[model samples]
Target chain A: MDKIEEKELWPEEKSLMKAEISRRKFITSATLAALGLAMTPYATLAAAPSNKPVNFASFVEINTTINGQNMKMKLDPRTSLLDLLREQLGLTGSKKGCNQGACGACTVHMGKDRINSCLTLAAQIDGKEVTTIEGIGSETEFHPIQVAFMEHDGYQCGYCTPGQIMSAIKVLEEDHAGSDAEIREWMSGNICRCGAYKGIVEAVKSVRDETYDKKLIKRTQQKVS
Target chain B: MNPFQYSKAKSADAAINGYMEHDNTAYLAGGTNLVDRIRRDVTHPDYLIDVSELPFSKIEKIEGGLRLGAMASNSDTADDENVKNDYPIVSEAILLGATDQLRNKATNGGNLMQRTRCSYYMSPHFACNKREPGSGCDAIDGHNRILSVLGTSEKCIASYPSDMCTALAALDAVVQIQTPNGGKRSLPLVDFRRLPGDSPEIDTNLKEGELITSIDLPESSKAFAKASHYLKVRDRHSYAFALVSVAAALVMENNMIKDARMALGSVAAKPWRDQEAEAMFIGKKPSRELFEKIAEKTMEGAKGYGENDFKIELGKRAIVKAFMKVAGLS
Candidate 1:
């Protein structure tokens, strides 16, 4: 429906295709009309494909806030937001055990909503607000959840501590996860391979029961709403 | 894994043309499934066409049901207001798939295209015909406890891993594709993923130049809104893939079945939507025997070898459990 699809192709008869033109050259990629990548050949293996312009996932500039910190970065579309923060932005607090969404090791808050940073692409983070483990509070002023995790001994090997913290923050955002069993069910995604689950549960319960503040609730409510 | 070229497609034709130009061009959206695989060397696309910027990111109520852009992330779709009220089954299925973080980044199209997580498939060193055709299928003779007994062959035994897809298939979605002719086509959700026939390499019937643009779904059913749920059983709690899963929607008129739809995942070559099983419940009441019979009908063609024989029973149990919930007996 755009200018590209609307463009009329100058006639190139399909009948003119030479039968003996080697199977390697006959892959006949669908890029007969593209403008980004096929224009030039890639390495030797795919050299037989058409000369139409092809494109790969490109780098883009994203201006966003992470953990109340506003920052800008030029990131490859393929670079997950979790990697961008943990690897590129010097935010080493986030962990990465199961990168494919299974283990919730790389959890972060985005626009007040907690999300698994590992599955999120940096480009998708543009114009949104993100909060990493480093963003929660300064050493002089620890976030209540952070203090609770520390006090509750909410970690053993500590690989999943950051993600556990993020999940606990988002637990209040969800309306369904209630009761100790529900909390356990909701927090189940953030696995502690070290079997530090009891500590993680205690850390979450401590925040929910005693230290949950109106200010934190307000921000989370605004996000959930 | 390798340093590949990247491009953000402005049009569907541009994406298709990009694919035509390179033998290894793959459309990158969400990258939840593809990126991890690439890191493990499961997929080796030399050129990645960025389609996230294309119009395929929108999730709106298009026809009677919702029209989800191919790039519409699972978290967004699960969180959409219309989806919550109208297509709750879709939302529920997505929610049951992964955690909030993963759902936020997984696209509907990419979710369906996710490769099976058969241990053999992920271990690139193992023999997996799905990863490398004719490499020799190790799962057939190996530990394939969670594999597809339905629509499976000796060539492959991996079960589809996306929990969201199980519900989408039950809802009768349509996948929109723009082909090389600049003409658009749609494949039914049930027929999108090719069965593990002789060639496990071909996952979908998609032609060489086709790019999935969106998924057009049918009208949201009242049954789905009133009584629908997805149940998955796995070794670990939240983060692991399903060992046996069920996506079911049922409506009852005075305790008699008025309508039913059921799909199974994590124990099939694809998300298995069986109308035959649904037929057993069309006019029947939910009873233990009736539920067992319905489950049996679903596995009418199940054929398993090696470690997956137990899945047949697990698959039946999972669907029965869903019926119990639908019947409000639980």
Candidate 2:
């Protein structure tokens, strides 16, 4: 929450700032030996130059909600959403295959729509909601799409499975998976290196058909009731 | 990615001011293209002013036609009822591009500002005039299967890989820009992108700190709207970039062509449009012979490098196919 003023610190001041931290740590034990002033950890840290700045960049505070959980962190401006998820939050479910938009292994939901997290800057998604694979399901209870993938053997190597499932859920939600061909066309961004096209298509198709049937039955039940 | 100062702009003026204050600054919208290049180290900016929150995310029916705000996502624009009905070619072209997820994040202005996808231009290991002014071009002799065949120069052969721009060209769209000096100007979409002349580094005619506010699609007649198609030929049926794409719109009256507009993509530095070729279609009957002649005329000045020589024939076939589909001949 602390906003540090970003201005270039002089060389002597930078070295003195570094020494001041070490001297403060040493003085914490030798309190009675010297100037007789005790400083708390917070006070010592706060004593450092509040306006200390780098050459051009500084840490940025990104406030966002991830999988319904509110999160706030100070991150480098260059950090991407994928890196924030995988490295910072330890949400490794989103694989970093290419780290580019070409491969959709790092797909996640930015609010209601899915996007390539690798291409999304962490700071840019400030105040936005992000949903990753961990948010979709856990080992105890799998999402319908995850269950379908398991039943249909939607993956071989399984590196691209998370992204595929995320995209597949979006495809059904967007009403784009009317058929196997349509599913493949819509899910083209997520590439399966093992070439598990057959199973992926089958998994998406099964879920799409089942979801449609469920809605149909609900309508029928409503009419009967 | 290099470190940069990041700030979100609340308004167009704020964004322009932020951009003007920094020499090496980029406006962040969608971040699909800019962030990708930043990660690749092909582009380095000292400041990134986030303009995604600017008040430019509207798609309204204007007096003449549609006015699409620069920040409107490609997905929203493509799925809009008015766009799908009135400008089906635009919808189809946007849909034919990157996958569903990408369309969700990619904005209309960002799509127009997409840099070339040439391998040499993207990788720092290779020399690209577009990336570095005097570095020389490796794509001229390297694997340039996807490079431009038209509107290329000795300095750069990178193709402008945007399907939406091709459709915008056919629709006669105009780009509305907010200049740094608090002025506004509009330019035709065809003139918005510059050909790879001596300065391949300059992609568009836009000046520094000039923010694109919106794009205006002029209203077309009922016939032109009805008979329009965006045909994209690619290595894969799905997310791959187009090998050769064509956006064709024709107005026909009683099996005779009344007006025609055609634009080609993936074969030029800019969206290739030949007025002479389109003019040949006017006043002519809808026939295979006329379509073939128009296709040939469109490919008149197209010169291909060794690896991309197939694009010439592919472009010709794509033009004929798009014309036929729009004319409802086949």
Candidate 3:
């Protein structure tokens, strides 16, 4: 990736340079833990500018993956991941009820976690993976959570159902999801205007219970093995 | 929203150069915030420089703290075991707001660049100064329930609507940016982003063509790490911007707070980091008396009109509650 520079910065702008230096120190350890590999500075990022000889300006490009597909495109420096998927790439499984990201209709998976696709840009997911409802298996062979949503009758209007299921699936991997209140608290981004919330709750509840059961089964199987 | 020309930047310098060369351009990251604003017609950029691929996508350790690459997805950042274990407040802030889908798509840089989620500004039919300079604001009397009560001008009252940013403010984090010259610098989180003040259109200190490379935390063993909590109060159970949200970190020694950090979200034009509250809580146990005193002091200069008076009460409650949760008081 390319690196850029600025015109001689104000005394204040120069002060901010240390923020990256400070961050790079800790971020390397965390990154190694998560990816189980070392991150080379400027190896992944663009090279730093030679010296200060430019003016201040504000636009840049982002490169990322979308819906389980690797993609590179020119975004309106402001194009959102949700908009690009739905509007540009035509991956419309993610809805756009509230463009401000309050509504979770546009939920999708980024690696192991779920996020509101509406608030993200298409250019930011470079080298990562995304899983939308369309990308999350199929109607015939649904993922465990998707099947659970079906068995639990998880939608009325069904607008928010995709996001709900996506969030629930991600919740299966988290430690903070303990009780019903916890589940509700964590799943707060999705809004079901038809008030299908009870069904949504039940779907998550069923998956969570099954997850616990699976954990127990794994423990037992390990002992048997 | 409006059809525009675009380009993909393979390197960070390319992205910066693309922006430097263009005038009406905006750098796009997660697009979770930027795309919506454009679709709503609030922003109309002529060109977009895509910089999501400049390799600043990982979260890692630094000499002092954690460095969250500018392009790091919120979803990835939220679920990082290190973030969960160390900067739980940051994860909690991300967890408490926005759905899983948006988190995956939104970037830390985008979250920082996000604008106010003002209802009036969102509407193409309404007039807004933030959207169009001197266009006049319809929110003063018209659907003013969710407008900011602090750091707002007569022209714009929109609050910067990022739950994660509020937590960032309290954490006293830093933002790493790459200049068009390729020189790197990091700014204090407080000064990195700006208040609406009079120039409501400008949100950050980022100059055109500059790329936000990452966000970093100070030796974040406590302030952002283990001793943190995020509390949000809203009208509905889900899918609503916080009516009032509190992000706090408190370290207790012998039942008294040794150090405290507090920031309020959704009430001000920018994330409101209450240094006053922090100074007040040091050496004080998080008792009811102390919490009430801190809230009163922070709320001293808070100004609100119309339906937002409830926010003051809610803000107080959220702070107290967040402190208690982090301090394990209740």
Candidate 4:
């Protein structure tokens, strides 16, 4: 606990995260107190501990910026970037589908490249910038890809949408979205069990060609204004 | 997932020292395969040394050909202008194997060092001699549609799953290694990976604590720079391992084959190269009959298990088709 407290937050995101962390801590403590349960070291609100006590001695410290918020954390070496985002930082936008590299539901941008967060350890992300689904445009200001997805009805269950969007963004930036077949090949890593590939390809193509409904984007921009 | 200690090495010597000092230490480069295996409980290490930031990530023009850094990511290596122009087979093989995201994270050295995708070797419930040395073999009698047919021993038959190495084998690339004593040595890429003859546990000829620094493509390989193709046959069109892949390059002069290079992937414990079979192509005119005969000769002595018996035929067809494309016969 002392080790986690010693970690510092970058000034811009400090107050927001501090308040969020305090509320979560309070809720955890109250729940444990109501149950009259002993505080398991692994379940404390400060940070998620490793399952084995042997790992506590080797908690690796990392300085990273996630979703544009600079954070310094001492993480269990076993904690993947996905776990660090969802478990410790309350950023659940990055879903954990397979918790393996086969499924790209945990895709996120690490230094301009879309990578499998589940396969990447938190210890490896030191001095790197990570961007998750939550870091993109807000509700009022939807990113072009988000608007395109909506316009094309790109998702059925929507579980794989975040990962699809993240990969699609790179597909455009890398100039791989020039054709539907190219988009499909580039986006093959992220699987949509609902078989929504046609819509996903259309959405990515629309975004690349700037062909998404301009009226919808105008409404979003108006809301932002 | 197992908990381990992680440290970053600032230099090659420091990385070697870290490996020498620690027991059961793995050099983490890209961590695409190592981390996945750790999560699967296939292999466990007490410490992980970060070697991804090493200075060996540059692709430079050397005396003969190109020197590709071991730590360079597969995407960067494939997209490199020199590799694309001089070694198109390497780019095609690398790009066709994995998805875009994986290509961005997987390094060339790590791709060569990756383990097989055999089902028995992957799951703990099944008996696998490669994962555990005296455990017994399950893939021998089990479903092995994706296993090897060319290089099967009584001990193990796990196919080496790498596309880049197949092209490297065809090109006769050499691996540069830095020993623990700061001495350097180079080995032909064909001899780097070993067959699973008596020992399936050891995959490569690399000794303990030795680090791969780069791979050199000899200038002599430019002979086949114009006509080369990598044909991979998989269950899916993308994002899957190859069942049988053929890498072929041919040099033609006046309608006669001047020089030829060929290698097979996902059909053996290592990249399958048959110089004797390739030699037959020299001075021969391009023909379907000649290609068929050479393909047969290349696949000689190949024995497949029940499910993978089709690979022998598939391998022959892929070889023929690859040669046809390379020679512009079809």
* Tens-digit lDDT string for candidate 3 (A1-225): 022243432211222243344545434433453474522221233223334332213233455565546666554444566777788887787888866677778878776777666666554555667777877754334566666666667787788887887777777677546887877777777777988767677777777677422322211122221
**B1-330, model 3: which lDDT tens digit per residue?**
455556668888888888888889988776667666666666777777766666989999889988888888887888788778777888878877766556666788888888877766765444567877776676665446677876778878787768888888888889888898879887888777677767777878988677888899878444436578888887876556788888888877787778888888889887888676689988876787788788887777777767677777778777888777777777
For candidate 4, lDDT tens digit of each residue in B1-330?
Answer: 567889988998999999999999998998888887787777778899988889989988999999999999999999999999998999999999887778888888888799988866765444678988997777787567789988789988899879999999999999999999999999999999999988898999999889999999998998888999999999998899999999999999999999999999999999999989999999999888999999999899899888899999999999999999988888
Regions of candidate 1 where Cα sits further than 4 Å from its true position: A1-88, A110-129, A174-177, A210-225
Give the range of the ten consecutive residues with the poorest summed lDDT in model 3 chain A.
A216-225
Off by more than 4 A, model 4? A1-52, A218-225
- Compare the candidates by TM-score and give the number of the best one: 4
Give the 10-residue window scoring lowest on summed lDDT in candidate 4 chain A.
A6-15
Models ranked on TM-score: 4, 2, 1, 3
Off by over 4 Å in 3: A1-150, A157-190, A203-225, B220-226
Please state the CAPRI-style docking class of candidate 4: incorrect
Query: In terms of DockQ, which candidate is strongest?
Result: 4
Candidate 2 stretches with Cα past 4 Å from truth are A1-57, A138-140, A211-225, B221-223
Candidates 1 and 2 compared by TM-score, better number: 2
Better of 1 and 4 by TM-score: 4
Please rank every candidate by lDDT, starting with the best: 4, 2, 1, 3
The value of fnat for model 4 is 0.49
Q: How accurate is candidate 3 locally (lDDT)?
A: 0.71
Candidate 2 — which pairs collide? none
